[model samples]
Target: MHDLIAAPFRNEHLVLRPGSQRAVKIGAAKFTDLENAVKAGRALPGWLVDVARRAWGVDTFDRPAHAAVLVRRPGPYEFSRATWELNLGCDFDCEHCYLAEKRFEGLDWAGKARLLHVMRDAGVVWLQITGGEPLIDPQFPAAYQLAHELGMQVELLSNGSQLGKPRMLELLAALPPTKMSLSVYGASPETYDGLTRRRGAFKRFTRGLDAAVAAGLNIDLSLIITNRNAHEADAMRAWADRLGVARREYANISPTIHGGAETLPSQSPEHLTQRAPFTGCPAGHTFFHADPFGRASICKVGREPNIDLPTEGVAGLARLGSIADSLMLRTGGCTGCQLSDTCRVCRPMAKVFQEAKAPLKNYCQHG
Candidate 1:
């Protein structure tokens, strides 16, 4: 059974068999072998055959054993983390805003509560609150309180527009350690405002940053590096410096894949072919996104119908569990890609842009 399952990769020097439940000496060290053992003149067990197929990268097996051995097996769930989008709408109209055409709607109190309960019960420890600007939602404060009450660490992805407002300030003052990630497109108002397509947005963003910093909030910066502003990396670094922050606090890169098709130039298949090493996407495994429609997705872009989150539930825990399983099984394009560590090509994002054949325009190689 083991040999049949591993026929394709038999030359890879991977062996599978069963023996006493003791450590097998492979080289200088002893390692415990957990595969099924072979009995005297007996057929392998069916269960062991299945294990060989999954653990040894074999596609087929007819027999089973009590134990087996192989050169490779599934790795531990290292990226077993999760991130949630608190809201979908954003206040700015940046040129690269992926969901630019989507309506700027906010979730209601009941919806927020239901979602929170679902996340809490699902053992999701990391939560991110985002929106057209989360502060726009009056219930946002209560949402934060609920997340804290449920023992989940929260992060805020905001444009910093309303941070300086009196009510928003009061809300910030009452919250616990919520990390704030602010988007800084350019160093100057002209560049930043032009990209956001809003006049005076730069002033509002800076004011909010100052207010958050003065209030002793944990803040980080996110930058969307684009052809228009790639040259400003050093200047943007200088801005972070003046703010008494580290350069690593900033995330600057262009959009390789935009959710809104009308917002950017089309990319060809040749352009979409990734030149860098393919790192496995850890979406369903480490992170997940729930759209306003209540659809759960792996990495905010996966579109396979069966892999998508069910929309019936508010918290989407079942969807999360399914996603985790799908990730473990390596059932999508992720399983075919070799770049599982260095590439940021998210399955969800790729699924969204698959029809368009968009090139990996985002930060493909980390600088």
Candidate 2:
């Protein structure tokens, strides 16, 4: 708090893009201009000073903290946003879970911090911490705090069950994230409990949302639609509105990470009719996922690691193109379908090629 506002200011160019134009350079003379502005009573955060220094001809390897910055990015799929599976264990037994039940394999606290440092070295600007339930992960809180301290905007994709606990609330108050996308299964206790099958889960969910909002943390509700609760989509959104939180509704269902079909979504024909233009997947191009253990993949459901994270750092990103190329083969239903022209499907790379699993029969209305 030593007059960070009045400190000497330096304007620096932050490298926001990754490609032929690798480093973004900002001149120290420009920094002198900003410092002149600061001397004239303009205020800015201490972190901006670090950013300016990193951009003013200082090599990135020297300053790990000033990794991400504001600039026109390279593409949506660059390693700009990273997703981490902090743990594969969850307290509640949800019906439509994407993660197959697996033994708990988590990185120790030091390992978690090191992973973030490596991602920062590769210039990841945004990070998402998710899991079977990231809140239950032993190293999650510390790892999350480290990401924010490293100058990355962090978000948590949580089920919101434990958000109201004394320890959980304390952690949020200490290290609030950019936002939390709290998954709300249904609008009612009966619907929520029926989906989650955990006693008092509905009460806990609401309590967690309320606690997060009270602590001044940005909170958003994500209502996942399954056949059992499809009729109540409006009610769930209404619940979010009542709580004064932003929300998004998810209606698509995907096979489990292991290609298991038992827990698949019971989507209706009308839901399958919804369509969007087929742009090439952002996966492998710019986005990548990592876990605490040895896994790294292009997408969340696409968990057959094309490249290992713990053993390989940013180098793994270079191989993503090969993985994406191998996935575009003429597979079962996609061989002659006209709808493939407009279908926004990318998981076949995981299911058909990597897992050797058959094409997900109910994935779309192409049949």
Candidate 3:
């Protein structure tokens, strides 16, 4: 059931195409799959599958599988997932934040709701709510509830600070997100405070994580590697293991949103080994980001060919495709680069932050 709800999140161009007698297609750029007999498909039957309005009732049946009359539309496709920044204000002041020093100006409740409706109309069914700290937004509940009512999968991106509060936990329990992605700073209080410059962030994060876990919410915990806390990598993993939640590690950093080289901890050679990229990053194609004020961009740093969310027509989406395609050209540093095979960095990223020089960062060990 979650698979069908999560399909949109996995694919930007996910669409319902008619196939064979009664099969439907779940498509991404480089991947496509067929589904039939969805209700009897999985052992875990979720509310999303039963209540799914957009893709449900197309040809669902009680048969085993492959027993429906399916059809496909002609060529054009639209986005399936959207990342909306409800607010830029955060309670934490991390040194490596890409959106550093941004203010908290956003549309009011009514206007924000309208933007969500637009996304739904345009075929976006997976809605990712993110922020410097999305929990800080006063209108977060309204936005979250609206996504649920629209039958979109709601994912919350947070730093896990305010989530520990009693009121916040109650609200989350009432209307849980499809999933929550919370960033973990360090393994202990001392290192966490050193990196985030907050007094008791580790405590808050742990408490918040416990609250969410206790409430039976799916959680994904992430750790961003920096010079200050790289030594705690193993410890961090063990801590997540104790909590029994999924953990991820991040060793990459990009320039600030306005192209400023914000103050970041100096890294040791160990953190940089083999971190360059061989392919372009996904900004316009797989998914796109939109800031609080409705300024839409392919990614956070590569905000080129930006369009306002409200006025983003077919032309706006087309511009995103053009910008993304331009980055794939085999020119200059991209051609015959020694780091091509092992590099995880992208072209537009290099151009924006590094003058397309110095290999994104000093993290590459390729000779």
Candidate 4:
């Protein structure tokens, strides 16, 4: 368990502490020297020792560089980030969930370990662990620990439903995430429970949220505004302010990943904001998303023609750049449309809306 990681991030060299956002930039020469020191099991560099102490209050002066710091070797790939869906199962059945089905099936421990290693080899330095609710996964603790051990800064995306458990809190305290993003459905139990279609959902959420705050975990609230709970948006922001945590609001609802329109009705029309016009993205070029089964796609929205990472390994990622290019092309109904010049949704997202048979006004500017 090293206290910090020194790695090459693309063209830059960065020294980073796991679970902390503090980053120290060093020249290429210094990065190479630190790497050599770790290889030779040398004592911690005086400068780094001072840096750790001053930045994080960590004392590494007496520790060997090899024992106290992990020096990450750069890989052939340029990817520095990724998001993995551990499982799709959730305790709550939110009406606006994008997944049409919430199955608990996914890779076993062995498969998961292999996929994570593949991600690490692909140069993923920052990994987001997500799911219908990641904390509820039985294998979460070991998997999270393994990600950190592999020198990847881990972020957790959860509903904060299971965060109140003693074991969960203890695990977070020992190895904090880069950030824990919790979804806030509502401020009160009635609206929250109603939105999630679960009894006592709000109670459990607040309990876990408060526990996380008290434990000093870096947390951010995702204020999910829906037709059912849009009235509580201000209250949700106020709650985040009271907790002294950061928050972002998400009011627009999308169709399910399976192209079902069931979730569209939950969108709060008044709160829907205009999306910027479609621009270029670096989804597969710089980062990718992996499903529970280790299927790597350009992103969460563009799911077809994915690579099976566990079976094909990291080598298969070579095809992603081309796949991303093809997915972004204006095709299908978007081809030659006069509004294409000002279209807000990307081709993949537009395809989803078209499949769901949603009204054009919901996704197209022309409507």
The prediction achieving the highest TM-score against the true structure is 4
Among all windows of 10 consecutive residues in model 1, the one with the lowest summed lDDT is 4-13
lDDT of 2 at 156: 86
CA shift of 271, model 3, Å: 2.3
Q: Tell me the spans in candidate 4 whose CA falls farther than 4 Å from its real position.
A: none
Best by lDDT: 4
Cα deviation of 220, candidate 4, in Å: 0.4
Question: lDDT (0-100) at residue 92 of candidate 1?
Answer: 78
Give lDDT tens digits, candidate 3, residues 1-367. Answer: 1223323433343332211011234344322233333334532223323333345463243332223212121112456667999999887888888787958889888778777776665556667899879988889877877776555667888988877888888877776676788998788899998888889888888888888889877788887788888899889889889989988877766566665665334343476556534645656875677778766777766676677767664346656777767765545556777656666656665554554234334433342
Candidate 4's C-alpha lDDT? 0.92
Candidate 2, residues 1-367, lDDT tens digits: the string is 0111111112233432211122344455544554454455544334455654554443233222212322222322346777988888888888877675845777777677777876775556668888878988777777776776565667889998888898988977776666788998888888888988898999998888888888888887888888877778889878888889888877666556766665654553344434355567766566778876736676675555467655686676687766765665446646776766665555463243224343443444443
TM-score for predicted model 1 compared with the true structure? 0.63
Per-residue lDDT tens digits for candidate 4, residues 210-309, read 9999999999999999999988999999999998999999987899998999999999999988899877788999899999999999999999889999
Q: Give lDDT tens digits, candidate 1, residues 1-367.
A: 1232110111122232221111112321111122223333234544444554565455544443322222232212322235555666667777766655646564566776776665554445457766656766667778777766554556777888988887787766665344778888777888888878889988998898899888877777776565555567678878877887634422322233344455444222222334444456556655666655444566544533322223354233345547545544433444665555555544454444444444445323321
lDDT of 3: 0.65
Ranked by lDDT, the better of candidates 1 and 4 is: 4
lDDT agreement with native, every candidate: 0.54, 0.64, 0.65, 0.92
Instruction: Write the candidate numbers in order of decreasing lDDT.
Output: 4, 3, 2, 1
- lDDT for model 1, please: 0.54
Q: Total clashing residue pairs per candidate?
A: 31, 7, 14, 0
Error of 4 at 181 (Å): 0.5
